[model samples]
Target chain A: SAVISQKPSRDICQRGTSLTIQCQVDSQVTMMFWYRQQPGQSLTLIATANQGSEATYESGFVIDKFPISRPNLTFSTLTVSNMSPEDSSIYLCSAHLWEADTQYFGPGTRLTVL
Target chain B: EDKVVQSPLSLVVHEGDTVTLNCSYEVTNFRSLLWYKQEKKAPTFLFMLTSSGIEKKSGRLSSILDKKELFSILNITATQTGDSAVYLCAANLYSGAGSYQLTFGKGTKLSVIP
Candidate 1:
């Protein structure tokens, strides 16, 4: 089990502005993932952020829109660029601990684009 | 494309009642089934089941997986008002090299009314 944390738990930003959300894990993880959840909806995988490599995004998400960075085994950041009101959602980061083979999630960043 | 579906999108039950949530998935190279409870922005892990017929329990929550049936069930016994939230079901797809993709269901909104 790993403890995950995110920065700026909740933020209100203007449309067209970008926001970078940071995620940090307590221990080394083999893989990290980013997810987004819209209101009254379930989570959607944004991308897979593996250390030392480019993030693999899921369909409907792209690097230009949701760029990801994995600098190390325990730290990752996701940037929501050219944000729009439709981009308002809760972004969450998860770390998959190889020892447990389970993915633990961060608190999630709630973004409101006005 | 892989997909996960959850049944009874929303349910309202009285406190002390036992409720069961269902999840059916068709994920390529399925590896595991996971359950999570979301009370706020972040979802807290509840259980992860990798094998069929094996049950994972934690206090009032118990979950079982049926790979043969391609489904899983989460049973909450003696529920409380605190249990009111969205319960998510995710299918973990193994893609080699210890990397996996988690596809989530729409989730079941369980409202435990007092």
Candidate 2:
């Protein structure tokens, strides 16, 4: 299992403002992913953060709205751009070892768009 | 569309009582099923089951999968107040290029009272 951490555990932002959440994993993982959990909703995949390459965005998510960057295997960032009140949710980052089919997630970033 | 469904969206159990959470999925190219416990902002990994009929246990929690039925069950014995949380189940599906997607169910919120 990998130790995952996210910066700015909680934030309150005005609508139209952008916030970038950083995720750091203690060890190198084969895959890194971003997910959104809306209030009373299930976890939805945002994108796959690929090292040295473009992140793969899932359906209903886009690069412009949620830009992700993974410069290395142990670090990644997710930026919510042009946020709206609907963007208020918990953003989580997960690290997958690949050797095991399990994914370990970080303490999520709680965002409140007012 | 691939989907995962959880039963009894919310459950209330008394301490020392046993509880069972169910997860069923209809996914293509299924690879694995994972269980997570969400207390606050983070959803902690609990178990990942790939094979059917094999139970995985940790402490007082145990889980088993039935691939033929496309379902899984997470059982917690002698539940405590600390065990109250939302339990999420996700199904991992194989995508191309060694990539995989995890489809999560709308977690079951469990409350344990003494």
Candidate 3:
């Protein structure tokens, strides 16, 4: 398992503003993923952050709305641009540990747009 | 598209009772199945089952995978109020392109009363 940390545990931001959530892992990892969970809904994959390359986003998510940055193996950031009430959700970051088949997640960022 | 499905969308049980969560998946190049517990925040890693017929145990929680049935089951014995949370099931899809993404199912919400 990986020791992962995320910034801004909870935040209420104004609509049209952007918030960047940071994810830091204590150990190096191969892949980092971003996810979103709407109220009363299941988690939805946002993107896969590949080191030194562009992220691969899932359907219903695009780079223009959620830009990801992975400069190295232990850290990544996700920016929610042009936030809206519909975009209000918990954003989570996860990484797959080499020693385990499971992916460990960081404490999610709870964003509420006003 | 790869998908995962979990049964008993929600369950309410008293403490000391045993609860079982089920997850079934259909994915190409299936790799592994994982279980997580989400309690108000991030989903914490619980167990990961890779091979069939092998059960993974952690304290009062144990999980087993059945590859032939394309499903897995997590059993929590002597459950407590602290065990109340959303139990999530995810499957790792090992794409031949040297990448894998976890497909999650709508979690089963378990509420344990004292």
Please give the TM-score that candidate 3 achieves against the real structure: 0.97
Instruction: List model 1 lDDT by residue over B1-114, tens digit each.
Output: 899999989999999999999999998999899999999988888999999998999999999999999999999999999999999999988977768978999999999999
Each prediction's whole-model lDDT (CA): 0.93, 0.94, 0.92
Clashing pairs in 3: none
Return whichever of 2 and 3 wins on DockQ. Answer: 2
Kindly report the TM-score of the first chain in candidate 2: 0.97
DockQ of 1: 0.89
What is the TM-score (0 to 1) of chain A in model 3?
Answer: 0.98
Candidates by lDDT, descending order: 2, 1, 3
TM-score of chain A in every predicted structure: 0.98, 0.97, 0.98
Model 3, runs deviating above 4 Å: none
lDDT of 3 at B16: 100
Error of model 2, residue A96, in angstroms:
0.6
What is residue A114's positional error in candidate 1, in angstroms?
A: 1.0
lDDT of 1 by residue, A39-97 (tens): 98899999999998899988899999999999999899999999999999999999987
Candidate 2 vs candidate 3: the lDDT winner is 2
DockQ per candidate, 2 decimals: 0.89, 0.90, 0.84
Q: Rank the candidates by TM-score, best first.
A: 2, 1, 3
After superposition, candidate 1 runs with Cα above 4 Å error: none
